[model samples]
Each structure stands twice: as C-alpha cells, then as structure tokens.
Target: MKERMEKRVLVLNLDHTPVGIVNVQKALVLTFLEKATSLVHFDYLEIRTVDRIFPYPAVIRLYEYKNIPYKGVMLNRNNLFKRDQHTCQYCGGDKRLTLDHVIPRSKGGKSSWKNLVTACHRCNTLKGDKTPEQAGMTLRTLPFRPTLSYFLAEYAERHAAEWLPFLEVKPVG
Candidate 1:
C-alpha cells in the first residue's frame, strides 16, 4: 500500500527568518486567514486579510525588538528531501538517496527530522551503530528543524503555483 503523506507546518522567526518548517495544514490556515505570515530570506511577508493590502516589514521588526536564535519544526519527507535537494548528507552525492539516522536507534536516536538525514546506502551501512566520528564521516550540513516558510514555498511552488503572487514572492524560476 502507498504510504500516507505526513502533513507539516511552517516555522517563522520573529525576525522573519525562514528558520524551519512545520505541518502544511496548519501553515495554510495561518497564511490564508492572516493569523500568521511567511518568512522570506530577509523579511516576514505579512498575510493580508483584506484584498490588495501588504504588511509593513518595518512593523514586524519593531514588534520583535529583540534578537532571537533559530527555531524549526517537523515537516513532510518530500518537502524535507526537496529542501535538501536529495543530496546525501554523508558524501554529498546525489544518487541512490535514502534516509539516515544521525544517531542510530541503538544509540537512542528517534525517528525525527533532527535525527534523520538523507544518505546513500553505503553511507548508512558504514555509519551504522556508530556516531559520525566513530564512522569517520562528517555531515556537510547540520540537521535541524525546517522553517514553515520553506515548506510553504515548496508547497506553493509545486502544488499551488497560483498562490505565489499572493505570497508576494517571485515564482520559482
């Protein structure tokens, strides 16, 4: 049987950094209803309740008034893999992609995004039951939670192209 796709939400930094991803259904409601906003690379794009309205970037920055660290959330696999662009974390190879556990289950790894990574079978077996140091492997990028904006951007680009303008971002070229 085909597996069900897990849903995700978007995570936004107070500074509007697309720090990580969240479940989709939650993000949709947040964005569509103006309860939440989208975080682009540099700023938070506000969701307008009324037509033709735009959010002021200055207002969002003023509201935060503090520097905050990065945050993230769980997202779907397709989206996760896409965010990683199907590159294997172990060797940076892009073929025979598979999910890997940074920390093995025997070592108390949970089946979660922060613990999981995209890898090739060779890397998976090589790194099995041992930490990266023990296995002589190093991650190209540290695994962390994804921002909601990343998920939304991915979702809209692939699933709802029409929403791009409403999102106030250029369509993926």
Candidate 2:
C-alpha cells in the first residue's frame, strides 16, 4: 500500500499557478483536510482500503492563496550540474564533471548562479584559483537562477499521463 502511494502529486496555487509538487500522502492529507481539492486524478488508479476505495489524485489545487516567501533554487552540486547540462562550461566536455567558480573565490567571487559553472576535472585544475580570463579559458554559457517552475516541470515527469492539463510541463523529447 505504501509503495503504491509513493508518487508525485502536482500542487497548484488558488489562481492555478504551479507552486510545487508534493508526495501523494501530502496531497491526500491536503484534500482530506479540505485545504485543497483534487483537480486531476491519476489514470486507472485508486486507493483501496479494507471496505472503501478512493480516487487517487494526480494534481491538487489549494483553496486559499498562500504568500510564500521568495527564495530561488538552492545552491548545490546536482543543481549546478543540471544548469550546465552536465557539460564543462569552459571546454564543453561532458566527462568528470565538477563545479568551478567563474571568478575564483580567492578573487572575491560569490558562489551564486552567475559565478559558478560546471567544469571537467582537467579544466578545474587548469583554472585553479584564477579567473577564466587569467586562465585563458572562456565560459560557454552564463548561468542564471532557476525558478520554482523549472523544478516543478522536472517533477512532472513522474506523474500519470492524465496530469498534462494541470501542469505547465511538456514531455521532454
């Protein structure tokens, strides 16, 4: 039962904007509490208890609009690599990935999106504690902060085909 229920559920704000994705359990809890309503249900799935069966929702919408604080995506290894498409920003190589400071921290570069790039181990060593200009290397792309919707779109892949209407996600080709 637990294994069957462990799926991603798309969550939307009151005005139908994508806010986040929650686990099925959280979606069920929200719907049961009347704080959210099921906007889309999974294809050909249901929750079966001892004596009752319930429709399993794939997308849920909040009854009230909650003002969430503005915070961009977290700074982490996985996300940094994702932003650069797992390729070295300096050499465009997709092997032995690592994070490199565009402007080395030793040179007062803050570790924000704009200042970081994915690097191969070779490039990382080559650019050690030096700006790309000083190291005679060039960055392939400028990184920017990813929005919540970007992560939300990635989460959409785990849901049922019936969820296409509610989430602003298109299938990745």
Candidate 3:
C-alpha cells in the first residue's frame, strides 16, 4: 500500500499537455473533487477505502488548460549528465562519469547547458584545461539544452510507459 501510494501519477492539462507529476494521493483527491479525471490506470492496481475500491490512476488530466509558463530545465550536474545520457561525451564511456565543460571555464566558458557535457574521469583529465580541439579530442555529441519533455520522455521509458502515448517527445538522437 505504501509503495503504491508512493507511485507517481502524470498530470496533464486540459489540452493534454503534460503539466507535472503528483503522488497517488494528490491524484486521487483531484479526481474525487472533480477537478481532474483519470485517463489511464494501472491495470493490476487499485485503491481500497472503507467501502470502495478505485482504480489506481496512472495519468490524470485537469478540467481546464493551465497557463503555466514554460520554465526551461535547470542546468545542474545531474541534469547535465541526464542530458548527455550518462555517457562520456568525449569517448562514449558510461563509467566513472563526471561533468566537463566543452570549453574550459578558464577560457571564458560559462556553466550553461550548451557548454557542459558528461565525461569520464579519464577524458576530463586528458583534456585538462584545454579545449577538445586543442587537446586533439572530439566530443561524441554536441551539448545542447534539454527540454522538459525530453526528461519526461526519458522518465516515461523507465518507470511509466502509460504516459508515453500522451507525450510528444522527440527522439534524443
């Protein structure tokens, strides 16, 4: 029961755009209050009360479209690694991952999404304080800013396949 309650529910706007995620409790409350409707439910799960059983909502859509402003994804070490798919951008290695600046900060590089990438410890050390070109190293992929949908799509692939049909995620490749 505790684990089921801890499961996240996708929340979509009236227009079916993903707004955010909520815990099962919050999703149920929204549904019970008629503010939202469950669009998909976990097939083998159900919520039991004193005298009622409700389908476990996997996704819920609100009754009205929200004018939520699109705040871009935050630039952080974890997010950077995720954006780069946890593989070293220089060598495509998946282990000993570390964040690297495509252009060394000493050379006027800012720590923004476009300037950062995931790299292995070896690659970081090999590149040192020099740009990839200066070190004769090349990145496997160009670093770019990631959108909310990108992260959500990645999450959906891992934890919640039910949300996939509703999301408009472009392939990361």
TM-score against truth, every candidate: 0.49, 0.75, 0.86
The lDDT values for all models are: 0.58, 0.80, 0.89
**lDDT per residue (tens digit) for residues 1-173 in model 3:** 89888888999999988899999999989998999999999898899989999999999999988899988788888998888888999989999999888889999998988889999999999999999999999988888777777788899999889988988677342
What is the alpha-carbon lDDT of model 3 when measured against the actual structure?
0.89
Q: Candidate 3, after superposition: displacement of residue 168 in Å?
A: 4.1
Question: Candidate 1 lDDT, tens digit per residue, 31-111?
Answer: 567656544321333334456644322111112323555354455666557767699888988888778878888999888
How are the candidates ranked when ordered by TM-score, highest leading?
A: 3, 2, 1
Residue 134 miss distance in model 1 (angstroms): 0.9
What order do you get sorting by lDDT, best first? 3, 2, 1
The candidate with the higher TM-score, 1 or 3, is 3
CA shift at 78, candidate 2, in angstroms?
3.2
Considering every candidate listed, which one attains the maximal lDDT? Answer: 3
Best by TM-score: 3
After superposition, candidate 1 runs with Cα above 4 Å error = 1-76, 154-173
- What's the CA error at residue 49 for candidate 3, in Å? 3.1
